[model samples]
Target chain A: MRTSKTTRATKAFEKALATRPTGRCVLRLYVAGATDRSRQALLRVRKLCETELNGEYELEVIDVYQQPILARNGQIIATPTLVREYPRPMRRFIGNLSRTAGLIVGLDLETKGKGAV
Target chain B: MKNNGPQSATPTARLPKCPTGIRGLDEITSGGLPRGRPTLVCGGAGCGKTLFAVEFLVRGAVQFGEPGVFMSFEETDAELKSNVASLGFDLAGLVRRNKIVLDHVHIERSEIQETGEYDLEGLFVRLNHAIDSIGARRVVLDTLEALFAGLPNEAILRAELRRLFRWLKDKGVTAVITAERGREQLTRHGLEEYVSDCVIVLDHRVNDQIATRHLRVVKYRGALHGTNEFPFLIGEEGLSVLPITSLGLNHKVSNARISTGIPRLDAMLGGRGFFRGSSILLTGTPGTGKTSVAAYFAQAAARRGDRVLFFSFEESPNQIIRNMRSIGLRLEPLVQRGCLRFHAARPTLCGLEMHLATMFREIAAFQPAVVIVDPITSLLAAGADFETKGMVTRLIDFLKGGQVTSLFTSLTQSGHALQQSEIAMSSLMDSWLLLQDFDGNGERNRVLYVLKARGMAHSNQVREFLISNRGIDLVDAYIGPSGVLTGASRVAQAAREKAETLTSQQEAARRKRELERKRATLEQQIAGMRSEYKTEEAELRRTDEQVGTRTRVLTAERTELARLRQADAIRAASRTPGKPKPKSKR
Candidate 1:
């Protein structure tokens, strides 16, 4: 069932890439340092943007160790946090970006919500 | 409370402390929270946990010259600043001076979602940046437990917190982590498990409908701390932990003396008055002139140019002044001159601790040399017996510490137990004067006596306490066959003695007159006898001269008769008979 879901998601992702939504999704991922967890979160968030945001989203990664002032301005508490900046109501997803499905739902990128992908 | 073994056995093994610069708190923690280690301060809602944390940071920055970082998870920077501004902490000014850094960690439960695994590295980074930006040596995570509600996955949160405390310790910055109190643990999230260097608990308890805030040091590692709970107040200055037991008997004493306004009373008190800075307990029954006596002392102190602070529990200041006026004590002038101040309040207006805190504040502000609490027993209605006693102890200790003479007037029930109510507080007093109302002589009378004077020679005699228009007077109560006489009885006794003395004086005058008359009559009788003796002497002289003249005439007549007889021998014999007759006449 998981394999079938992934294939279907891939086809929709292609369609989204071709259509290229007008409102570019702005994303920022805040992490502590160049750790394994931060790397995994970075890779996962990038993949999510490419898949769900149709390669039209702007993604930026912030290492809190280097730019701590930015982290404080962003009110980041937990490391490996993904912030949806362009969204009207800014949302924050804490923890390493290992649960892609929840992140997709949380970021409101469920393919226009055909019953939550 | 836990004692962490032999770590505090030696001075070298003890943990270096960071002085909090909080009143009574440093004395409780011996110095302060352990240096370079996180101290967990947990308390229930509205127990002053956040205030305590903020004060710690502010004091560190302002007083200790060590900059601090305040990372509040509950209140924003503006909110926290405004909240502590009431306590006179200029947080904004401190922040502008780079002595403090405020980081309000906004955490909302609805805004944050946990996916899988995470750590609080962002928080750690922000804290580090804020600290390094200001060179902060102190850090505060005020109510950090808000993170638990804002984020999911408690397991990760716990592990991250443990790491965060370790990081803070390793950073060599003293940190205070405030948390919500738990039902079964020290904190709601058991944060005590992470920050174990020291744990302080703040409590807001309402006992007998009186709410009081208490602070306790539950555990201290490698340091000795006062383990008992202490009453603390979030006053205008800041959070002050009133460690009542922290006051020792080592306060310097003054050998100076002050009067009680009433000269006779002063004479009774070792012919001087109460010792300077001495705590005096003036206990009496209702209408026994306790307040009057206290007013006298206050007036005396004010007259001597010593500032007097009067605490009236049973009457208003104006009322006290007016009542004292009836006894010729004019407090208005002293008040106008700024030598006397009156703080009047109802005992039931607040809790005992609040009352104590207010008294302390007044004492500190006024800096009075003499303090008078009129009818202190009314405070018994505010708390339990032991609590009242403790409050009095703290008050007296605070006063004596400043070398301020204090007078406490207590009202007692009119019975044999009049001397028993204030026994608990009498031990803390340097002198105790007992005033009683005697019901005799068809009227009630006030009598005062010194019950105890620790280091002075005080009169043990009771005196009649008379409150005339001239003021309070301590006259010798007539102690005679009947009993201690006062009021009208004393007057009547005095009058009777005066009458007796008059009668004796009149009798002495009458005896002196009688003796003088008898002496005059005897002298007259002796003069009359002398006159009679003089008359008899004159008559004797006349008779003797007449007899001599008759003898001479008889001798001449005998010569004529001898010549006429012309007889020879017989005439000689007749002349011899006539000569014998003349001899007989001689």
Candidate 2:
């Protein structure tokens, strides 16, 4: 009922992969207000998730101002924190999500060579 | 941030302080933590750092009418509330009244990745939301270092921490950040580098198998604070800090006197008793009735309708009360009447400071005019001699400052050894009474001598201290060559001396009667000899007179015969005178 962070993340990823054979990638991006850095991080992360996963992913953008509880629960420290919640392992990129090449490898898209899309 | 709104009603100019409302802490902090500044509290595990930070927030809300927000990175809201529930701080009620906000941030380091340079905007947002929701004037980040432990990237954590302090100050909210102490530095993750306005260190350790909690204000930016390690206590009441150094020697001196319960003992102390509000020390070897004397003093105070707080370290209250009843000192009635309160505790249970804190609290709550500590020597087990001395010195100052007369009993190893500790505190006492056992003629007896009494001409004579059903009595000691005699031996010596006096007196009476009888006999003998001599003189006189009468008769006859003869012989003799030549022969 109250599992640790690693176990819960593993179980959630397994459930998602079993439900969708295409291997869904669930991403959540937490940011402060509509600042330049937050907007830039949101644009890059959404473009990468939507293009590589090709409708096999769910992207949720959260502004810490209107809903700070979720941001804190997600352990979002930086202004623009992008978290890949599914795909067997959760990875975080805290900058403006710049360097799409590294973001792609970090998201496991390189291992599949964008084949899941 | 400086706008004069309801949220920013904290005065800006009044020393820039936030009073924590903990006993003895505000006095040490020179008010409290730096206002609207991030103060760091760091300690080892279970050292009371979190509790200290929580008390800061709770007291701010409850006492100062300022709300608070507690953001926990280690424990959940339920855990924090349950932990503080024992102290009677109704955290749930406070939260319900919107005076406290608890936002427990669940941070798992492995699940989150640090991509690049980032700021803690989400934490800032949540904290801002909590503060604005309840108009919190105080904020606490309990074990913020736990986040660094969870998040591996120390560089980013360190950078954001530096800015977080400034942000809290800019928001005009006094913040307390709890952290774990590093092995070398003040904090494990060096959080002190960021929250540097004020630093408090809490420590818990066991020495001689006795646990003691200590608090030290490591640094206060602009205010002078107590630098010494103060002993603190955590109990159902709350954390109480006890400062070892007395504030100053500014206590008022009282010249009024009170009785010592024993009338003769009072007489020894210049016909009255100890000066009111003065410290009195009772030192003696074991079983010398030191506790008894202290109890009598307490009873005397109770008899005057004044309250007394009796702290017994070696015996339970009921045990002492029962023991006193044997000596005709009924303490239970005094307790029942609410004039006397007894607190019995083992000195080894905690460190000396905790004991001091508890006593300070109890004294304030009871507001006693008199206090008695029976066998203060037991406290030595909790600390070294110097530590115990420091504790007693502070106690003496605190009690004297409150105008409360305090009586203390100490067990010394020997009558004259005067345990250096005993002597150390005796120097500060206004009166010192020494009780000792006088072993003479094979039995031990209690003797009391006033070693010193300030400002009064006290009697220096040692008195035999007696305890019986009638009560305690101090009688002049029967001083002899062996020493001051006491107990059955003293009574036996008195009886022996009394019998010797009677025998000598009877011998003197017998000699006087014999001499009187001899003088009367000699007078009778003289009277008998005088009467015999007088009779002899009478006999001699009568014989001489008879002889004279006979001779006169015979001479007359001869003369008559001679005259007739001389008329015939004087005519015979006178005739013999004619025969005178022949009468010359006649």
Candidate 3:
């Protein structure tokens, strides 16, 4: 399930105190309509999440059409809006979920600049 | 005095209300389509019927933060979402947040069996559910005509639409109902005849082979709205209606003057310049240097660190800059410095109202000290004559209220020699410059003249000008015997005069030489006469000498012999002979 930014951030802080895990993250994709573009984005994001954050992450997909209340809750304006809910300091990206490198950087997944992944 | 006796009773004063968010649409309606009442949006096919209703909902939600609901009779939720995506409105997001609800009411005309009695209660229930679920303050019905296709009974369909509009009012939601325009009636099935609060008609017409979309507010009870048809635009930015009406006489005015950047031209306009916030019309035929003059004004304003918004209807920013370069107007640097903004678009792309709204939005965003519309006449082609005039007047009034200096260029027919006749906005303009091409001596010359300037003295004389690589330059007008020679005629006349003067000087020198020769001949003859007289005297002297010599020779021998013999005899008797001869003579 997609959690609010503040709640997810608070949970991350609590987890940091409870257990010093090596790496963990939570990602959510907020899309307006389920067009071919949004479908492609969902598929690509799912694959990336499974491969990258295999055991220590949660991925949730929210379609604004089916769930418009969530869109306003997120203050989303454009379609395929992705919000990085976890890891203290929330961030969001608007557009198709392409550009893996940019997404990784945006999510703070890589530890170092070049070889962290 | 008697009217003040019953002052004790006072009615509750009604507070001024905000419009139902359509941008400039609110200002035209004075406040907006009466609050919480049904305002019908009717148009023909593909004339933005659905989009207009949707935009009213979207703008209300996003701009005003008011919750809205959209009831579509034709399209599904998915179709509406994607269609509005290009306009940057995420309708689905509004839906997800419960701020907006999109009800896709499916109606199959072939399947529905119309009994003796038919009502829109099903649609009303769905509408009420959507509106209450979101607490929507605004609602839109895509097209009421769609129900006619299903229900054959015209009387029932019309009655049902009337009931639906009344229901919306009772629910206290400001609703916009879209309907198809009919060929025989203002609305399909004469729906406009039944609607009470307000009726707006959307039209898409082709005139002179150009397609133009227009919106007219037919009736708005208890509210004042522009009664003229307004041109509208639908694009990535959504639907913008241009309300062509003045904002009335409450605008602020300033006496400050701003330069148009052409020094001589500015000098012509009251030695200072035009009023700071006034609207100036630069009208002329093609190639009369309208764009150059506007660019020069924009660049000048930018140089003073004041922001300038330049709207070009004909040329792109690059083309305008490149062309201005010929006249020494460098706008790229100013644009780079963020002092100047260049917006270029085709006038036919949007309706007059949309263009004006876009202009107002840009002005609000940029907050420029000056705004320039390269050619305002291009917009006139999009509407009827009266409509065009109203739109321009309203635009000028709005600009004046905001204290933004507006410059507009208009293209007139060549050789007409008349002021801008398409729209009667000349009197409304604070300053007017007339540019024309005068055909004289078989050559066309571009000339600029100030027609009128209110509250300022301007040059009335027409000045000759040239559009060269360096920019526009005011050349002194050539006054010839026939009339004024401008452009090529003046240049040719100057050359011809030089040639004539040289030939005349040569001819006069030839005459002088002939006179000098005749005088010399007369002088020589007089000198010859003196010589001849001397010769005659010399001959006379020589003849006299010869005569004297002959006489002396002839008389010398006889006279000497007689005198010698007489002297010898008379010598002795001379003493005695003198006394005897004297006595004898006595």
Candidate 4:
């Protein structure tokens, strides 16, 4: 069942890549204090990137505790802040990664049913 | 709530004004009272009429180095000094230094007779002489009511009082004439209606058992003054009026965010912490660790190279720092580095508005990123509920607009669970941390719950916390069959469990005793039955032996008789008579 799904997903990915192959996006997540929510947000963001952007996107995870100055400079007030630094407009979304749809829209990603290519 | 006059530019001329030198009072009256103008201060008894007049003259002479004259109709200089000694004002020192001249004018009302119309020329000479002796610029008449009493008719006395005020005004000297307030008018004889350059009304009223001293500028000509009833506190430092309504709004603001100390707390407040210019209210009951939380936030901000100011109304600065140290918060280093400042003053030192003004002035000078007012409720004792609420609202607005992260602590009364004051201040705050004493499982536990934080995602669950030598630590909330335990109920539950265990032990002992008694009774009965059976057996054995012996002896005698004499007769009779007697009897 897993092999069948991968093959089917590869087919769809190839079809989409064939149409729009140059528009790649990079995402970075800023988190303060290693809490369960932070870990969940990280995992969710990674999983969503893998499923949606696949290998075309670059992701960087910044732990604010290890870099307090960066957190201050970025004006990050809460933990699990996801920032689309590489993308245009440089939008930032703060929350647990549970809200995948909201993050997708906030990061300016193409939705599954609308605005593809 | 009413504005007294049209907004007009104050004529900054030589209108004799005496500087009260009482912090906000001087600022509110536009450089004190018309320098040498005789201004009447009328109020009821114990309404700080005497203290207000005394502080005006004493502060002018002592603080401003202006010589003053104080003439009293009620108390002597010694009595006045003793009364104000607790407030740290040295009235006698000023008198000895030739800066103050005190005169007690003793007048008997019955001895005076108004034979002819006369002005207060003698009183004027005495005042002028006292002023000349010390080169005085300020004069305080403790009670003009005594002078009124000395005159026979009210009509003549009222005219003379007006002339006296005019005379002092012409002398180019600032005079404070105190008069007892009448039930209907501003003064006992309506003297304020006559001389109307400036009329200040002092009121002492008890609302819901709280005594508050308020001063209202009834009329101040050529000066823009606050027309509201300003709360004033009379202490060792004389009279300090709390001016809450007069502050400029054009202050500089910063857009930076500051840390709240606890990393998790900071995370909840949007990884960076609170907005640089925001007021946070940490409200809870006693022993809920509100002070500890505030100290943690201050220390955190100070560590990050940001200045922090802490104003405590309950504890002294030393006591607050010492208590924080015991709870693992070190503020001494921050103080040494000039990044942290701790100011502690009694809430009763001044009225609520004055306390707010003092804090505003201090914060303005220090320009701290974070400021903490631990327990703002204690300072509200000097004003009414409406005044306190207004002051807090204005303070929140001021702090927020200044871009300073302000934290306030409030003690919630038992029955008043709803956060009425905090609710009023909620919209002005960027973050709200609600600390509470949760009673659960018969134990009182201190729990902190974030009610709301604008522009940041925060934990909604209430977390149990402990304050120790290291600092504040967030512990997991107790989850059990019973809810959280707190206060006296927790102790009573433990005692009850202990009593139950003791009762169970006693019950077991009682059962063991009952069983032992039953066993002993059974043993005694068994022993008695064994002895009776043994006796019966012995008796039975003896009877059997006797029967056997009789049988043997009879058999032997029968044998002998049978052999000796016709033998057959005894033997046959012994043997056959048994069968024959049976047949014959039948």
Candidate 5:
């Protein structure tokens, strides 16, 4: 089931890479330390941006253990939190990137109905 | 007992405390909250939970010299600073001095999405950073329950909270975690399950339409704390938990005496007055001069240069001043001199606890040597009977603790048993003066007598409490066939007795004069009788002399005839017999 879901996500990412970017996406990933979850979240977010947005995004990774002021400024309470600072209304995604569907919907990368993305 | 050893008896076995420096709170907690452990502070809305948390941090930083970190999930940095500024806590100054660090952690659920399991590692890192920056020894997470609302998963949030509390403990920072009070639980999100070292519950209850805030230590692991709910107040200074009953009867007693302003009343009270640092209960019916007696006491104390704080629940300060002026008591000068202060408020202005808190605040601020509560019974209108009694007990205890002489005037109902009704508080008083109205001669007059004066040989005689324009004068009430005659009846009784004495004196004088006149008339009659007897006796003497002369002549003639006849022998014998008879007569 996990493999099939990944394949489906990859196919959507390929379809999104075929179109030009409509708007720039500003993302900030806040993590506590160099933990397994932080690494997984960073990799997942980087891969998603590279594939879905096709380099139409600016991603900043912040380690709360080192740069806690940024985390505090961003109102980060949960570890491995993904904050979308641009594309108009701001949104945050909490937890590791084990589930990509919620993140897609939060980042406005959902290609279900709206065609603006 | 767990057989902890001899140290347990020496206080070394008890939990080390981190003093919050809040007034009366340290007394209730037996020092303060458990040191270096997470304490859960739960309360309902507007119950001063945030203030408690803020005060804990501010006091920890400013007073105890231990830096603190305040991570508020609800209010921002500026908001928290301004909110606590009214309490006189300079949060900004503390932050600038590196004694405190204010970090606001806001989480809006509407702008967030949760996909999977996550921990509160970000919060821990932020707290760690803030604490490390200032080397803070105390941490406060005010209203940490906001996380439950912000996060989507409760199980994970609860797990993370457990870990966070443990982490706080490992960090060796005394942490205060405030949460919302829940129905049938200590906290809304069951935060008490974690942070179980100590749990404090703040309650704001409205009794008889008056709101009062109370604090109770619900749970304290391995530490002793006051379990009873203590009334607390959020005043200009800060939160003060009143552990009034805990004051006990251990206050120092003073042998010094203060006058009651009325000379005769002082004479009645053992030729001096009430003892310094003693609680005096003055109970009377309405219009029976209770307030007058209290005012006199206040004036007396003020005259002696002792500050007097008058708590008038029945009348305003101006009204009291005006009324007292009618009795020739000039309190305006004492008030102006700052020796006498009047705090007047209606009984229904607040709850008994609030009233008590206000009184405590006033007493603390004024630092008066004498306190007068005019008509303390008015406070009963704002609370239950037992509650009022408790409040009075606490007030007396507090006053006694400060060595402040207190006089409490209680207004009793006209027909209720005075002593019986006052029995609730009478035991707590060191001296009790009962002012009553004697109804006779178609008028009611005030009478005062000391019902009980502990450790003093007080007068037992009832005194007529006269409130004239000259002031209170305690005159000896007329005690006669009518009990305790006062007012016009006493004067009338005195006048009647005087008139009776005068009439009896006049009757005695008139009878003596009549007796003297009768004796003089009798003496004159006796003198006249004596003169008549003297004249009769003189006439009898003259007749006897004439008879003797006639007898002498007859004898001479008989002797001449006998000699001529020459009968010498028989005549001589007769003459001898006559001579013997004459000699016998002589």
Candidate 6:
């Protein structure tokens, strides 16, 4: 039931991904507390920003318990919510963003649409 | 008899309940929204979604003494404060008192671009911050559906919304999330799916140019709730949902009596008036002085030191007060004394359920012993007949349960009395006062009759209702030949009777005078005769005495000669009557 497809939606996504400049990245990472998942989420988001933006990036790591207002403003439901706030269309990923391939696909960093991207 | 959607009353025993404290809302939901679980409130624009959310928080903070956090995504804190100001909720003051926390989450579609990946973690954090700051037990996310518009991420938004509900449940804070109704679904963004505890649909529709608002609980995961589309209103008191519940017949019966304000009407109602806590329906046509009668009742209740709440659908408070003055009912003093309260609104101003809800709210607040709804038929113009009946049934139940006397007036079309028998609530009414306008003899006459009075014997005779400067009066209707007479005819009938009485009285006086004259004549004649008889008797006595003296002198002279004659006469008499000559007789 979930595998139904619309090619227009796919084309739209690829177009949005290709049009992005990706020069200066803005990231807000939300973590719950001083736990393993929090530390892992923070470390992974920081590493991705460093490598991807090449030092031209602003990263905001928010501890949900300490600054819950910011997290709530971001509509954060789960801790370790990485929000890429720059570009034309904002995208969100759950978990710590530890899987680089999954995170890459979610962020549209490397478009894999053959007919479009 | 209309089917009001599907009725699903699944017992939700597992989920703890959160009472919203809004009038009639808790009753419909059985206990309230599922406790600590997110309940989705989806509605069209301007259908009281925001007000309902705000009221939930405010009521939580004020009534339940539970601190709440109102996280609005569309309106700012200032806007919200001003919006709810009419409801008497001081949002800022509540915030200062640490009873509530207001957080505005504005989402703009043009503010962001997609770089890598993002989540609505900020919203969660802010809501958490507000909750923690006040130790809130209730949370409201006002229109989180803005995210569906501000951000082009339906997949992620839907995913995050589910997580939010789960998180709210985990935090043990009851949350209310409002969303706009979708074109084909309850919520535009499918927020109903995420909030499994409850999904309430608020509908605002304009049928025949009359706008009405309705609310329905489409699904409650674990609770029993009314399935009908209840009409809700956002007024000075806030959101009140009118639950169209049946009268369970569990009202506490009272034997006390209260007056109908009109002495004669009271007389018609078994002397003292209606039974205490009884529902009285005063039905009449236009301009039959229904309001005046109701005002009289309010005056009576107020005069008796009982608080009275008068709801005038046809007239404003000032208008009623002024109009009642013509009938000598001065309600302004009672209002000033806080014994009489007036709630006036147009029948078209709100739906039937909304009217019921507003009445319930006012009744709860004023705590009046008597509630008078002048022209309750006006509420029929707002909704279908069945809906109004359901609302009225619930209202009667509520008033009866509280042992509060309630009076409802309805306007019919004509004097036929049976023309607008549309309500058919005579069974529920403890007493029904039917007023009629007798249009005959080139005049309109008002008449009142006790159509029905349950639990008491009431007069079956229709009386001509007389409205004077003093107050309302009911004169016994003349049932002579004509069906019923009133106004000029009644007065003329009374005058005619008075004239006949006067003529009869005059004739009686003349007969008495004639008899007295005859008796005086007879007495004079008798007196004259008595005088004559007395004179004759005196004359006879004098003559007899003179004769006796003459006879005695003659007898002595003739004694010697009579001796010889007397002896012969005695011997002849003895021979003739020998048997009579016995010893004693001799």
User: Better model by TM-score, 2 or 5?
Assistant: 5
Q: What is the alpha-carbon lDDT of model 1 when measured against the actual structure?
A: 0.87
Per-residue lDDT for A1-117 in model 4, tens only? 999999999999999766643656777777655767778778887887777776678888887656644554453433566667665656656566665665666554654514432
| DockQ of candidate 5 (2 decimals) | 0.58
List, residue by residue over B1-586, the lDDT tens digit for candidate 4: 1342332323444344667887557767877887667788999888988888878877787778888999888897899988877777788998899999888775544323222223343455567677877899888888878866655557756676777777887887888889999989899877777657788998987765566678888988867777878777664356767653356556555657777787767766667777777778777877788888888988888998989999988888888788888987888888999999988898877656557767877887899878898888787666676888767766776676567778888788754644676576666566788888776555667777888877667777766676667677775564446765434454555667789989998999989888888888888888888888988898899899988899878876766556556565664564554644554466
Off by over 4 Å in 4: A1-117, B1-18, B113-117, B275-277, B283-292, B302-384, B393-405, B410-418, B434-586
Off by over 4 Å in 1: A1-22, A112-117, B1-14, B416-421, B517-586
Residue-wise C-alpha lDDT for candidate 5, range B334-450, written one tens digit per residue: 999999999999888778877888998899899999999888878877877876777888888888889999999988888763745489789989999988888867899888989
When superposed on Cα atoms, how far off is each prediction in RMSD? 7.9, 9.9, 19.1, 39.6, 9.6, 11.5
Top-scoring candidate (DockQ): 1
Q: Candidate 3, TM-score vs. the true structure?
A: 0.61
lDDT of 3 by residue, B28-74 (tens): 77766666788887888888878878888888888888799887778
- lDDT for B213 (candidate 3): 81
- Per-residue alpha-carbon lDDT of candidate 6 for residues B1-586, written as tens digits (9 for 90 to 100): 2343232323324457888987768888887888888889999998988888888888888888889988887888899898789788788899889999888766654444333344566567777778888899999988888777776657777777888888998999998999999998888877777887798888888776767788899998867778988777776777777753434566678899998777787777788899999999988888898888888889999999999999888888998888889988888999999999999898887667667777887898899999998777788777776767777788888898888999998887873566433446666788888888888889998888888898787899989888899888888888888767778888898899999999999999999998998898889889889889988998899889889988966754454345445667544443544443462265
Candidate maximizing TM-score = 1
Task: List clashing residue pairs in candidate 5.
Answer: none
Candidate 1, residues B1-586, lDDT tens digits: the string is 1465555555656668999988889999888989999999999999998888888998898789999999988888999888888889999999899999999999877877778788888998899999999899999998889888887788888888888998999999999999999999999988999888899999999989988888999999877788878888887888888853366778889999898888898898888999999999998888889899899899999999999999999999999999999989899999999999999999999888778888888988999999999878888778878778878888888899899999999888888535554887889999999989889768999888899999989898988888899888778889999887888989999999889999999899888888888888887777778778878888888898899888868865765565456556535654665664664466
True contacts kept of each: 0.82, 0.62, 0.00, 0.00, 0.89, 0.23
Please, what are the lDDT tens digits per residue for candidate 6 over residues A1-117? 334466777878899766767467677777777778678778877776666555777888878778766665676654566777885367666565556666666666564322222
Candidate 1 per-residue lDDT over residues A75-117, each given as its tens digit? 9988999998886578899888888778887876776644534
lDDT of 2 by residue, B121-166 (tens): 8788889888998999999999897777666667777778877888
Worst 10 residues of 4 chain B by lDDT: B110-119
Q: What is the TM-score of each candidate against the true structure?
A: 0.88, 0.81, 0.61, 0.54, 0.85, 0.71
Query: In model 3, which runs have C-alpha deviations exceeding 4 angstroms?
Result: A1-117, B1-18, B109-125, B151-166, B190-194, B244-249, B346-364, B377-387, B412-414, B419-423, B436-447, B466-586
